[model samples]
Target: MVKKIASIFGTNMAEPKGETAADRAYRILRSAILSGRLPTDRKVTEAGLAEMLDLSRTPVRNAVGRLLIEGLLQRRKGSGLWCILPTRDEIRTIFDIRARLESYAAARAAEFATPLQRAELVASAARMALLVDEMLSDPHADVVPRIDAENALFHCKIVEAAHARRLELLLQSTIDVNLVTLTLQAYGTEQRMRSASHHHEIAVAIAGGMVELAGKAMEVHILSAASFVLTDPQADHPAPRQGKMPVRPG
Candidate 1:
């Protein structure tokens, strides 16, 4: 069972300390789905999932229920559970909402971000730029995962800086995790650098308390990403998960 999930996710499963069995199951399955390891057409069963996770059906069942509630999984009348596959229009609509919501967040962040929060946002952008350079320099470097993580961090910092609980919740529900991974995977070298530059500009605007500029930068960043994904056929297909970037030996 462990071997099966490892093969599917391309990494060994780790049970974190103090995590309940159900939480562990949920985290693993959620990662699998959001990381594009589980395709929409893949057949999934409670029994199969339980076997793969090396857990009893109870925890896996509980996890499945949660995923369904979160709209990560949908139950069919007779077809069983399937990963949610948003249509092109659905994705476009999602991005539309994301642009507005995140723009407001960035604007508010410009007005209210603490010194530390601003610093963190700028630092995150710098890190993403470094990651982009590494990927460009090394043809074999697996930098997608790192870039994705850094990108999420940069956005999250902006949200945190905004300090509006309700807005944060709205953004959380609006952003599709699965779509994020696919978009990053589809990005070419040019697009990746463009994205990194946008991040830097947004961060600088927020840090300098340029509220309107921050908002505009965020909106343009999001709309450009949408344009890239909408025009690229590759964005519609989920690629195999990339491993974490390997650390260079000193």
Candidate 2:
């Protein structure tokens, strides 16, 4: 079935200068995925998407192929192309990779972090601890969202402190999957406190220029959080559709 593009812009609008049809399709599709408008497991067909965007299949195919290569899209036999539906092992693997990259970032943070960056790391941890404290004092304080926001700030400051833009770029998608799509909802008060304590240790190690300790602290922080997610039956994740070829056990 053909779908015409919406009249967000009046008819007879031409493609922007210096942008190809594929480029235009790609930006729109990526925005949909990133914004959760096209949630995980939602199917996409070349013809359908091409028609929806008022583009040709050749360009739509090109755009989808690129997203597929980036791990944002996956293909199943019956399901065709769909948003990512990660399995348990896939989630674990993502964390493993994050742990490694973050370890390196933390170590570098210790060695190369500026005084201002170290101060920010400490502040980030302190702020996150305050959120945990608030949640504990009033269970219905409506602070989980605050904690999630601080969680991103806490880790991001560490990575950004290292002055490694390339590393940050590499970890952006994994971080988004955790911070944006998934969350720390699986953690209880005790777990939140433990994770908070680790952040403090990380901040201190970085402040004191303890390279190995800083790195280990970061590793522990991530793995500990990942443990909660893996064990939580209700953890937010993209579930694999049944009847597809099963992913091998890890």
Candidate 3:
């Protein structure tokens, strides 16, 4: 039996720009994975992807390699490449790392961030707030993805302002993992929007030169979000016991 293949583009195709084939392939595949088009736990083959993108095997292989290193894709011992799906324990560990790193970054950003950096952070936060408002007004809006993207940008800017490349890269990796979990757990909810607003508060505190306040706010924000995702109604629950087991008498 033949598997159904999705069309590369249902619309007109513009002329290709001067970008490298590998770069194009990377962007296309990354976009698909991030946007949920190539969903979690889905198997991806080099030949299938090459056919879909109208490219040869080499570029697709390079793109897949980069994605695998970025933790967006994984290769099994006997199976092919599959989209990375973090276990519950992995999710908890990533969130714990993010909470510590982001809080420290927020504090350092408050202390050493330049005026221009502060202004940019403030502007990003304001833009994020407006996006949140838009999402709240129309739950079915197409801006949901954009909102998530911009929210990520806002946090990224804060981390960059801290001027810690090591921390930034670590946070970025963990964030990519967290985003998959967030997308799975947080589809549409007013509470999620409110949680985003709290992120804005962290930005405001940092911009105001309140280092301790910024750190505390960021810590609370990350922990709360992690907890929400872990315990949300849509999240996986424990399975029921199969049979009665012998119990020791007290």
Candidate 4:
């Protein structure tokens, strides 16, 4: 069986200029796993990935280690690495934790953020909004990753502004990149727009030093994500497919 790696990375597997082999491997695999191109039940190994990616084992091994640490990949007792699939309750709990931490972060950002950081948050949110609009217009465009990256930047900027090392560390454990990707993929136009709007609102509130307003906006935004996941029919991820995936990059 063969799969088009291009379908995962939105391009052939050629390493981009300035990207190392390991970085390329990580990007390719992360996109596949997060986008659900690599099914939850599909087991993978570093050696097998190296061969399929047309790379040496060393780079693939490094990429695999990173994914394992990020909680995107887990090793089963009798299996190799497989994509992690959280239960509904687990998903809810993750969002709940995120809500509390992020709301506080937002308030702190409102209080302590530098001028440049505030501008960056606004820009990031605006970028995501534009991308969402593009996605709504051209449903076939592969811009999910672009938007996801922007969303990550937006959140990261907020945390950086918070100036709390412990909060940043806590968020590292709570944020499931794979789940976040899946959630975005599942979002309808309305949900996506609402999310973008929330980002904008949070950014504005923080930038204006409205601490309570920013905190409330952040909490609402996070809870809205939870509500969408719990209610949306397409939110349940982890569909298992039986077969060998592609052996070579497309």
TM-score of each: 0.82, 0.65, 0.74, 0.77
Best model number under TM-score: 1
**Clashing residue pairs, candidate 3?**
none
TM-score ranking of the models: 1, 4, 3, 2
Model 2 spans with C-alpha error above 4 angstroms:
1-72, 75-83, 173-180, 233-250
Once all C-alphas are superposed, what RMSD does model 2 give against the true structure? 10.6
Clashes of each: 0, 0, 0, 0
lDDT of 2 by residue, 1-250 (tens): 0011111101112335688889888867764664455656456787877877778989989999988876778888977787763557877787788789889999999999999999998998899899899988999999876776666666767777788777766765444352223435345789889978998999999999899999999999888877877886744453322333221111
* Segments of candidate 3 deviating more than 4 angstroms: 1-19, 34-36, 39-43, 172-187, 233-250
Clashing pairs in 1: none
Model 2, residue 150: displacement in angstroms?
A: 1.1
Error of 3 at 175 (Å): 4.2
**Candidate 4 segments whose C-alpha is farther than 4 A from its true place:** 1-18, 130-146, 234-250
Clashing pairs in 2: none
lDDT of model number 3: 0.66
Predictions in order: lDDT: 0.78, 0.70, 0.66, 0.77
